[model samples]
Target: MSDTAARIADFIEPLRVAPGSKVRLGRDFDPRYRAGLKKREGVELLRTGVALLAEYQERLAAQDTYGVLLCLQALDAGGKDGTIRHVMSGVNPQGVKVSSFKVPSTEELDHDYLWRYARRLPSRGEIAIFNRSHYEEVLVVRVHPENLVRQKLPERARGKDVWERRYREINDWERYLTDNGFKVVKVFLNLSKEEQRVRFLKRIDLPEKNWKFSAADVRERRHWDAYQRAFSEMLSATSTPWAPWYVVPADRKWFARICTAAILAHTLMDIDPRYPEVSEEARNDLLAARQELEEEAPSGAAADPYAARTAEAKDEHGAGHGRPARKKHGRG
Candidate 1:
């Protein structure tokens, strides 16, 4: 890693949730933290990180051994879309799959909350991004406990032990994935209530952004405190070594993008994916194929197969032989 890369990695270290440590979302992390980087510098760093991430993605695709799952959770206007747009713009689209979870359908509701998300997990050699992930079940549903009744759980399953059990299930699930060659990266874009309000205002006031505004988004702001508490509890209980959470400060969109790109770049670098090695026989076969191709006549040369075939046909037909001279056709 270069000095800049090292600095970026160091800067994001504090954002990571330490395993088994209590996390107080509002008290521990500042929404406006910027590591003293100005907007221009942050954007430059973000571009660098994005370039490195693109390279890493290519390697991961070629290696085809492990997968990366990036889960992004946030409140309304928290910049999940923007982060995905900017950070992954340079990566090969074939190697990346993005799934945005919305209100579940009847079929999805019939299964466990995690079932739908599990179906979208990244395949080996691919990067999968969840715009709003399974965390919503704990955060949004917990804040609105009434939503659970619709899940049709038995009385026992709906008891006070539910949240704890879900937390354990989630941890175990992530550990299972990690043990089986998947790297899970969870990021929470921690934006402040005030910033969210400003963004909402922008959505309403700007014509181009008006399409993004929804009345439900404004109503959800009322449960900000509840969501924060739920998030804090979720982070505390489920941030395991196998799948850690990074609480990114998202007040400044540029800084958030840079931090997210840097973290992703670091994770991919740690995975250290590489192109698969070729056996000696495969290498020799490739060398022979290259030699055969090189020996072929270049396009437009006299030895070109198409050119030789055309000449042979002309001679066979005696088109160039002395005979009654054919009159040139004229435009009618």
Candidate 2:
């Protein structure tokens, strides 16, 4: 492996919550962990990661055998948007899609919670990023059970065990996706309460950022402990082998993005996608077409625009040393 790749793997290992490992967010992880990287160094690592991600994405698309689903979960101002913007900046837009989930619409509310997220699952050979994923059922809904009554779920499905049941359901769903060729990678941007407070203050202090500040966001702070417990439990229950959770420290935005890109690059590396190889028949067909195209070039190189382009192409092919390009002139 390249030194950079080896370093990235080492960097990400500490962030993964192994399957069946109990999770205590505050006790086990530091929100401000940057692994001793300065912002400039982290940016350089992120640049390497983004370039690797783009190269792998092209291979993944051409291979068309696997897809990737990246889930980002975070509290208010935890840098989810910035992570997506920077980590995904170099990928082809057509091969990558971002789906942001917020308050459900009336139509969305009418179906099972997973229904909305299921509709956005990545097709084979594409990447789909979920800004906030189906885990919201366990995080937000676990914290505020009042939203349950709004759902008006069937009597048997609405009980104290609902959270545990939903966890099982989500794990099963992810496992199914993995077995079928979609890799699910989940990241929780772990931000400290103090850092969150500072971000809120900054939002209010800057005129350009004022629109991002909402009074309700402050009100939500009152339930911070509840959300913490909810997040901890959700991570514990869902960090399975099929879909592991990486608790990225969001105190440093650049480091979090670096970690996310590293994780994505690793996932693509595991998939090892490659362009389809041509068959001997296809190779001969290609050679036949090349001959036809070469023959189309008129003897005089400057007459027709089409012929001029053909002559230029033939000249490029003709100028190289070594074995001659074949001509099937006498063949049918």
Candidate 3:
């Protein structure tokens, strides 16, 4: 790796934290967001990493022994959607699936908080993406507090303890998934509040993007500091070696996407998937099938063997005829 690439890798490494540890989230870690990547260099790195990830996606699918769970978390307008779009554009859609979590359905609320997420787990040899995942329960609910009452945990524990317990539960659940066969990669698109305000305004001012805006977004913005605290705490509590969070600086959209793609490609490379080996008998059978298809006679009205014969005979007899005929026309 080049020095820049090496530094990027090292920066992402600390994001792989163990459960119960503390993590700091924000531009404090990456002060040079916009200055770090100019457009051309950023796009080049993003394209390169995405291409590698596309290959890794196919390899991971072929392996059939490991699956990747990519979770994306970010404040609104932090470029989570853009990261998924640009960074993962090269991956084959058949092997990759994206799940966008909104407010839980009544049925989901009835079950364990992790039930919906567990059901969406990637099958063997697949990549499953969570747009906004179970982390919301701890983050949003931790900030809003009132949201916890809806979860119906034991009445006695429905306070700060509830969020803490959920954190422990999530950590244990993730550990279980990792031990079983899942490679989890969580990314928090860390955009500055100023950038977020600009994006929100863009959505409101542009008629095409107006639908994405809502009064609720303003409500959430009021609790920005609270949400940040919750996010930091959640990251610290749930981040593990097996499933680490990458805090990608989102102010520069291309930079964030490239970093996220590189992280996933690196993770998938570790799985080491390859094409299945064929036996001698299988190879022979394949060759026989090919030969049979090639030797098959044309049938029904579609058969036109005489066409080939006519063309061959005409070519042998009339090689010079067309040239002379064309010369006479030109002379005339």
Candidate 4:
């Protein structure tokens, strides 16, 4: 396979492994898969991708009929934050939303496991990214079965068939979303346990990243083997043709981000959203309004103070500095 194709294949190959499977993709799949691109023409493609996805954001936002759902699943310290930040940098925040799932709250526990997730689903003409999502209930919760009891699934629904049944439900749920105009692109950030240990240690060693470490993280690492088994089983069961998984290698953060952006760009283009054309009457009305605004708009500086402040802010910060400042290093 070509390098990019091989990268993609390596990511998805692990999903085919059954639950409790002790397989490692980094070794099973060639680590040198992307080495050939190091001094080659990948830069031009990456630049082209930036402009292409920007245009896609415009077209996608204009369609107003469908939305893009980005599902990012990863172990702790696997670069989920970095992937989202770099890969989605080109997209307009007005048309994009992100939700980070945390431990269930009292209110969240009262509803079905998927209830909290459904509330965060994307609206038409927007993109929604889940840093970690409903898949956690299957992966993490499976390893810690007590979580299943906490979610309050009836004892009957929590039968021996629970895991398989959850898979079918998730597949049906995704198909229903697709049929109703949602395009789902799921990415699993696959980092080796050894790599993760290095990252976790970095978090503790780096002053800025120290807040990201917690006692719970250390505790979770203790259950690493169980989590892997759960993840393998979850992927094998839930990966469908409609909502397939892309297992991104997290050993290299930049490469993983590039792969994610490529996946998003391909999915958006496949949907073929386009900007709506103005009708003749609407065009004339716009022209007339433009003329009137030009006549009435105060000459040089008085167009609007709010507009002036916005312009000054844009010039001060780089373009697309809409949100408040964020810490440069952290984990969520």
**Which candidate leads in lDDT?**
2
Error of 1 at 63 (Å): 0.6
The alpha-carbon lDDT assigned to residue 320 of candidate 4 equals 53
RMSD of each: 11.6, 6.6, 8.5, 11.6
Please list all clashing residue pairs in model 3, or write none if there are none: 17-239
Candidate 1 structure quality by residue, lDDT tens digits, 1-332: 86755776788898999989998998999999998889989877888888999999999999999999999999999999999999998999999999999888899889988999999999999999999998888988899898788877889999999999999999999999999999999999999999999999999999999999999998999988999899999999989988989999999999899888988887898888989999999999998986686578577665446657997687656755764444569976
Clashes of each: 0, 0, 1, 0
Model 2 lDDT tens row, 228-252: 9998999999999889999999998
TM-score of model number 1: 0.88
Stronger candidate by lDDT (1 vs 4)? 1
Off by over 4 Å in 4: 1-35, 39-47, 287-332
- Against the true structure, what is each candidate's TM-score? 0.88, 0.88, 0.82, 0.78
- Once superposed on the true structure, which residue ranges of model 3 sit more than 4 Å away at CA? 1-11, 14-21, 26-28, 31-35, 293-332
Rank order by lDDT, top first?
Answer: 2, 1, 3, 4
Model 2 residue 30 distance off true place after TM-score fit, in angstroms: 0.4
C-alpha lDDT of residue 132 in model 4: 98
Kindly provide the TM-score of model 4 when superposed on the true structure, using C-alpha atoms: 0.78
Better of 2 and 4 by TM-score: 2
Instruction: Give one digit per residue, the lDDT tens place, for model 4 in 1-332.
Output: 45644454454354333333344444443322343455235455556566667888889889798898999998898888987877767778898899999999999999988899999999999999999988987888888888888887777998988888888888889999999999888888888788888888999899999999997888999998888777666766776777877666667676666667777877777777888999999999998886676568766755556667898787658645675543558776
- The better-scoring model by lDDT among 2 and 3 is 2
Question: How much lDDT does each candidate structure score?
Answer: 0.90, 0.92, 0.79, 0.77
The pairs that clash in candidate 2 are: none
